[model samples]
Target: MSTERDRDPAGRARNARPRDALGRPLPYGAVGEERAPEGVVRPPDRALAEAQELLDAGRPFHAHEVLEDAWKSAPESERQLWRGLAQLAVGLTHAARGNSRGAATLLERGAGNIAPYAAEPPHGIGVAALRTWARGLASAAAAGRALDLRPPRLRA
Candidate 1:
């Protein structure tokens, strides 16, 4: 069986941790170009971009679907990272629907899962803020705050 990680844009790394925009520890490795396992192929960047765009547009559920498709195509080892992002997307979807607690849980898992990868995340996203955001999600859950999955919304 071929895994998608083999075809990741970042290529196959032996236990490499993915990072965020700023450079923090996430739960997975960067997606890159490498030979896929037989019939499997790498997830397209277009899907990831679409998901991100959805998040930007306040459409987390739609974003989740976009990323979910990519995630499923990703390798097993990398799946957690993708799943984490997907869950975070779902959490954000819930948050948009006014479900803070649900959002908190999913976001928390997403952040946790992303931790290992954050150590060496891919390009674009901010690593420090991502980690901080993840931590903030857990804290918000603890304090029962209406957690917002939206990234860097507090900034102006």
Candidate 2:
């Protein structure tokens, strides 16, 4: 087998390794869950809906990838909101993977990132609600308590 890294059209190396639902890499040639495509830009509405679907399917890792794409491709004014959403999704992934401390930190950080937008949220993103959810989950994670792991609503 060629030991070459997979390359996208632009020649950036992409990990061709298969990943589990939580985004953990599996052994070579192992069949794994389908991954979200990298670097595809989506409008806020479409991105939120797609991420929500992945979250509901218990694929926070995939959700994070979608949100990360949004964050990377969004205009400067919208970067924080997308970043926060991505962080929350990754927080969920950490929690699912049993990294409680990491999960807690990320959840809290995500909440803080989105807090500024609470007063005038854009694209109908539920900033206040998401902040609440992130905080609650953060506390549970910090306490090493079990997480109920409900997906957050992306929009009001």
lDDT, candidates in the order shown: 0.59, 0.93
* Residue 115 lDDT, candidate 2, scale 0-100: 94
Deviation (Å) of 4 in candidate 2: 5.1
Report the lDDT tens digits of candidate 1 across residue range 13-80: 44234433222335554553221122233355665666666667666665666667667887776677
Q: Model 1: runs farther than 4 Å from truth?
A: 1-44, 123-128, 146-149, 152-156
State in Å the error of residue 64, model 2: 0.5
Per-candidate TM equals 0.61, 0.94
Candidate 2: count of backbone clashes, pairs at least 3 residues apart or interchain: 0
What is the number of backbone collisions in each predicted candidate, taken in the order shown?
33, 0
How far residue 113's Cα lies from its native spot in candidate 2, in Å, is 0.8
Q: What lDDT does model 1 reach?
A: 0.59
